[model samples]
Target: MKVMIRKDSKGTLSAYVPKKDLEEPIVSIARPQMWGGLVTLANGWRLELPEMAADTALPITVEARRVAGGED
Candidate 1:
C-alpha cells in the first residue's frame, strides 16, 4: 500500500518495501506476506523474475485495467 525506499551507491534497487510507518524496516504494510513471488537473478547477482511472474504481468495488467474500467 505504501513504499519505503533507499538507493545504494551504484543505483541498484536495494529494497522495495511498504509499511505502516517509517523508522523503518521494522514496519511493513506490503510485507512479504501479500507480495510473495519468485525472485531470481539475470547474472546471479542481478535480479530477475520467475517464469510465472514474467509470463503473467502483462495479461494481468490488462485484466486489472479492464476490471478498473480503464480498458476494454
Candidate 2:
C-alpha cells in the first residue's frame, strides 16, 4: 500500500494511508532512522517501510507493506 510519512509541527512522526483514509501517529520504529524496517502505529498497525536515504525529506509518500495488526 501507499503510505505518507510526515512529521507534525511538534515533530511527531505519523503515517497516513490514503486508501483507508486513516492517519495514525507512529509509536515505535524498529530502526533508528525509520527506513528498511518496521514502524508501529498508535492504532497498532505495523508497516514495513522501504529503504531510503537517511536524509530523505518528510511528508513524502512511499510504498510500504502492511506486516501485521490491521484489517485488510
- Best candidate (score: TM-score): 2
**lDDT for each candidate structure:** 0.24, 0.93
* 34 Cα displacement, candidate 1 (Å): 21
Q: Tens-digit lDDT track for model 2 on 1-72? A: 999999999999999999999999999999887999999999889999999999999999999999966545
| Model 2, backbone clash pairs (residues 3+ apart or across chains), number | 0
Candidate 1: list runs displaced more than 4 Å: 18-72
Identify the candidate with maximal lDDT.
2
Off by over 4 Å in 2: 69-72
Name the TM-score of candidate 1: 0.21
Cα deviation of 56 in candidate 2 (Å)?
0.3
lDDT of 1: 0.24
Which ten residues in a row are the worst by lDDT in model 1?
A: 61-70
| Candidate 2 pairs with clashing backbones | none
